[model samples]
Target: MGVHLDLSLDADGHHTFQWRRSDEPGALQVAPDTLQRWTAEHEQFRAATARWQQVMAEVDEHLLGDRR
Candidate 1:
């Protein structure tokens, strides 16, 4: 099974991200900065993959258009 992530705002107005196992009642608290870094990295990866996919699609179209 996969771990679940919970995100919430604390009473002090700080963001909290927690990772919990399915069988566990408690969770491990993730640092805000760590979460921010992880989010930024994920977005960067997503953008790069999207650009790559678009380029591949263009290449496929360029190559297959004459055949179609």
Candidate 2:
């Protein structure tokens, strides 16, 4: 995916999301099934990954009871 962003020379730096350029980038599209499968399986989805894991934990706990 081509975004309006860049970086280097600082490995310990943060990454940021940027808007797309005026011209459309073809790389933005992934297979629809792949995207859905990722959302269903992976706990990681960009920077919101932590939130997803937290919610999954809560759901599991609610179903199985708190293990703590």
Candidate 3:
């Protein structure tokens, strides 16, 4: 929750973007390259998340000596 940006599609089929900072009281002022940075960060995050999921799926639950 430190700092984050979001992008979505509105009902009118247009792109909506926003950024927030938990340390600040209001919306953040975006820089010119904000979208470019978000795109790169999001791609890296997605790749890392997918790799994590794949690793978890390959793990043997019995190794932890726990059952759910």
Candidate 4:
């Protein structure tokens, strides 16, 4: 009766998401809206991470200029 969602890497090493119910035999494709939401969330996460990395780089430059 319960459902499970999992994230895994495919053969090409890309991230994939799958969901299944206890009574189901195989993984089910994610719904279109759910997939779209996940993609949007992932993009937001990536953008946030990139901004963080840039901030860290600037800090490093300010602290360790011409040394690193």
Best by the TM-score measure = 1
Candidate 3 clashes: the total is 0
Query: Residue 57 in candidate 3 has what lDDT?
Result: 69
TM-score-better candidate, 3 vs 4: 4
Ranking of models by TM-score: 1, 4, 3, 2
- Give lDDT tens digits, candidate 1, residues 2-68: 3458789767576655554454545445566766777787678669967998999999999899798
If both were scored by TM-score, which would come out higher, candidate 1 or candidate 2?
Answer: 1
Worst 10 residues of 4 by lDDT: 18-27
- Could you tell which candidate, 2 or 3, scores higher by lDDT? 3
Estimate the TM-score of every prediction.
Answer: 0.59, 0.29, 0.44, 0.56
RMSD of each: 12.2, 9.2, 11.5, 7.3
What digit string (tens of lDDT, one per residue) describes model 3 on residues 1-68?
A: 34465779767576656565655655455564765687688678669967987888668655565665
Best-to-worst order by lDDT is 4, 1, 3, 2
Residue 28 displacement in candidate 4 (angstroms): 2.3
Clashing pairs in 2: none
Q: So what's the TM-score on candidate 3? A: 0.44
**Which scores higher on TM-score, 2 or 3?**
3
Q: All models: lDDT?
A: 0.69, 0.52, 0.66, 0.70
lDDT of 3 at 38: 78
Q: Which ten residues in a row have the lowest lDDT in candidate 2?
A: 1-10
To one decimal, what is the Cα RMSD in angstroms of model 4 from the true structure?
7.3
Number of clashing pairs per prediction, in order:
0, 0, 0, 0
Q: Where is model 2 more than 4 Å wrong at Cα?
A: 1-46, 66-68
